[model samples]
Target chain A: MFDFPEFFSFPLGDWINITVDWLTLEWAPFFDVITIAIREPLVSLEHFLWWLPWWAVIVILAAVAWRFAGRRIALFTVCGMLFIGVMGLWDETMTTLAIIVTSVAVSVLVGIPLGILAAKSDRVEAVARPFLDGMQTMPSFVYLIPAVFFFGLGKVPAVVATFIYAVPPCIRLTNLGIRQVSSEVVEAGKAFGSTGLQLLFKIQLPLARPTIMAGVNQTIMMALAMVVIASMIGASGLGLEVLRGIQRLDVGQGFLAGISIVIVAILIDRVSQALGRTRETGLRRGG
Target chain B: MRKVLLALLVGIISISIVLSGCGEAEPEEKPLIKIAELNWGSARFQCEMAKIIIEEGYGYPVELVPGITIPMLQGLRTGDVDVYVEGWLQNQQEAVDTAMEAGDIVMLGFINNDNWQCGFVVPTYVIEGDTERGIEPMVPNLTSVFDLDQPECKELFANPENPSKGLILNGPPGWECEIVTLEQVTTYGLDDHYDVMNTGSSEGLFASLQGAYDKGEPWLGYLWGPTWIAGALDLTLLEEPAYDEEVWNEDHGCAWPSVDLFIAAHKDFPDKAPDVAEMFEKWKLDTPTLNEALAYMLAIEGEPVDVAIWFLKEREEIWTQFVPADVAEKVKAAIAEM
Candidate 1:
């Protein structure tokens, strides 16, 4: 058998620990600001969703579904909402929705810029490719540890964890969408004396709309998937219900919560896909 | 060519059939005892140890299934699992009550009494300054949970998020301690000065403490004994009012009651495997003995199964007393060979 000396140990874990400790100490104020920024909107959104009458929310969602996805999906959306309410998971479902919304919102705000950078620069793309792959491939639960360490426990950390887990798809798709824009169209825009910003907004962005929408759709789904795991770090709602169910072995409660999550996922997915398709057709027709 | 191919195929089938027959000729009734392994160290080690003994000693095949408290209890009910070596009954009163009412599970015996203790704890450095580590005494006058009432003492544990109020780290969501600690905070009127931060898991709680301890920062959190973190860390259990059953139940202001860690089995367990059930009745461990094993696990950073084997090899006198002479010899022989 071969042997290795103790002196060869790199102590990577110690170095990570020291770095985390230093970061936490040095950037406490910045973290606090992030916590408040995320927490306030999440709290307001939860309250707004819960405060509205059930019928009102149902009607609103159905109308949106109808406008985007047409009659069949609209019907499905109404039924799903009713089922969620009947199963007595309405508030929990809303809490989960609020979390997904907040996480996706933050992920988009941060992710889109990175996607643009990666699309424009070969060097940036080279660096970002592996990082995005790591983010996508890493188990969502692993995010919760450092999340708790940095944000403390509760919805803030949960949102942070969910954002990290959900952001990769949006970034990847956005970059891909931008790169996939027809080179001829870009050249034509440049030949017409369009500014760089004008080209990006008027030509490339509109062309990439469908793919970016797909990215948004993917980001939303990933965020929802992460909701349950985020409950481990104190994000309340359907995830907590599921966690409670597992803890007490309450099969009924767990199944109902899980079904509610699926229903919510379907509603969001249909509406977003519909919106994307509608815009895609309009672009084709106009062209 | 066709005739030769048919003959080859027939010969291969015949050989496989003979081999399969030989494989099936072994004992047709070897019972598999399914034991539940919990996430925590103590439960994992205890169940693994039992699994090794039952397999080697009684010649009963065993399977270890990993699960948390609730699902494992459910497994016991539905017969998915045959035994759970460490059942913290008090924390799981509701589920235990329901199962007992249905007559689906039975408490075998206490594994250890006074072995499991849960309460508020502070790093020992808070009280006794560590000169070698260059850590100052942050809460020198802190003697009891009551000392937290003092503004200065409360300030010592102030969290960055809520600097106005000190934070007391509670157990994870859905744990029995979370509810009890929440009640205690309200009852003690400490909620005004202290915010109860419920950690995600025992791992989360321990990490918070470990991070604080490494930085020589003051921390206050709910913790228990016979755990690797407790056994390894230098922490001081804060004093509390003596347990008064009536007051404690209604208000939960007093300290946590000592937990009787025990083994529990499915109702049909005895009928299905009488010998194993009987062996479970005799299985018992003292606090120091269990703590020592947990400490060894911590020191070597060993997995539960490996630690169980190590324990079996080292603690022959303790385990041998539980089983008959022949079975004991068998287990010892198995360990020796390993």
Candidate 2:
């Protein structure tokens, strides 16, 4: 009998690795392009040329909350900002906030319209639902891989990954909100000879405002969760602090950063909830 | 005249704002080289050293990306990461094999070639206890793997993941220990003597090792060298079957030889940022220096940056190897002035 030992004598591992290289050659450039586009801007913002001041941004945030939400939400926002400041993580928190805000803004611009379209057509919703489910359920780490593959790493890839994470909630919420519009309101608009655009602007979206806001709220929270994980791919901010803590086993820094994130999350949620309440009151007055 | 002046001022302000929004000339951009740094003791120190040079020494904004071994390799192959500094070639042969085959990564150079391997180890007390049935004093002709078949050695492996039999502590599943240990046991005909218990985190492995060391209990499992575990505890390796390259390769082989760590970079790094690549190539750390840095991070300072600074300060001579002679003197002068 021939000895089987000879079969395993070769550097099987090295040979196998060479084969994998042959396969990935085709798609590497696309990953490189995406990485370059996303990472460069974020890197500049993080390192050399941060545009916004922490206190100024906080003031603006509080002002927006007061205008849209109410006194309670505005107060909560101030407290949240103060907590992070007191913890000495104000800069880190602001950096994270900038990434989240930019990503959410971009995601909304892309997701809301797709959500509206999906709600309007049965076939579209059918096509979108599974994709949304996969997006939601797929492990967050896996999102980073495809992101890094497509974009590379840095601020842009980080944001793209964050967008992937934050988009699902907004899309689902937008679709849900639009679909939940009262049939009577839609009918009244149609009777008034409202066109599709007018109906969307006047009836469906207006009625869906609370649900859409809820979606936005969820998106914000999801984006916050992705912040630290994104740091694994070079998206710096509060998450980098948390990542450093874990890497160096610094419990104090990790927990403090984590607590700051919790405060920010609560602050955002309450402010959004208050805004939703204001919208509800406005709807009541209009009705 | 007042109204006209006011309108002109408003126009200028609006134009500036639009200009700032529209053509705020994009700041000079550079290709970001993503380097994945593992959380393991040596790996993290290597990362800190590389990051210090890349960020401060070379002034290239490097992102010391965080990840575990398997994912880091995945990142490498997929172009998610440009380089990984502390890839242990022998232990991570499988992952490296996959990555290399894909042509996603290139091996730059070795970082350090220190003595490191994995195998079963038992405390001194265990060897002394009931020498025939227990681990000690070569009782019952316990010279080879066949001696483990004795009934008294039943509790040899008892780790949680595989609690039913003799225990073997598993590090990360992808580690070479998994395959090598399995082969060692099989070749020595000790397959029925012990069971391999898989554990995911280094913390888990250490915690178990510490517990056994403290109690002086007979513990046998996979471990590597130049680590805090070896530094902290004293243990002896169990006998292994003789090494035959052919039989070994077929059987998954013995404890892996120590691998040289590397400081790698993307190809564009040299073209776009030659200075950065020059600094990287010149970067090297001996085993003792890395061990000392790790000890400081884990034992003394307990901060990555503090450890990095300490190493940089303490090893001024080592760093001079990388800098130009004049620049090296300047660096020393700067360090002294600071």
Among these predicted structures, which one has the highest TM-score?
1
TM agreement with the true structure for every prediction: 0.84, 0.46
Docking level of model 2 = incorrect
DockQ of 2: 0.01
Q: How does candidate 1 fare on TM-score?
A: 0.84
C-alpha positional error of residue B190 in candidate 1 after TM-score superposition, expressed in Å: 1.3
TM-score of chain A of 2: 0.82
lDDT of 2 by residue, B1-338 (tens): 99999999999999999988876444555567677887777777667766665654454567878887766667677777777777777766666766666665666667677656346666555655544334344333444445666766655544222344666555533355655676777766667657654433354456546544543355666777656666555566666644456666676445455566665554444566676566667677777777677667766635566676677678878876776666555445545543
Cα lDDT tens digits, model 1, B1-338, are 99999999999999999999997675646778999988888889988888889988898889999978887888899999999888887888888889989999998888877855678899999999899999888878998888888999778888544578998988887888888988988887788999887676776777667756765778898898788889998999888888889988789989878787878899999998988888889998888888888999988878888888999998888888788999988988988887
Error of 1 at B97 (Å): 2.7
> How does chain B of model 2 score on TM-score?
0.75
| DockQ in order | 0.35, 0.01
lDDT of 1: 0.86
For every model in order, what is the iRMS?
A: 2.8, 17.4
Docking class of 1: acceptable
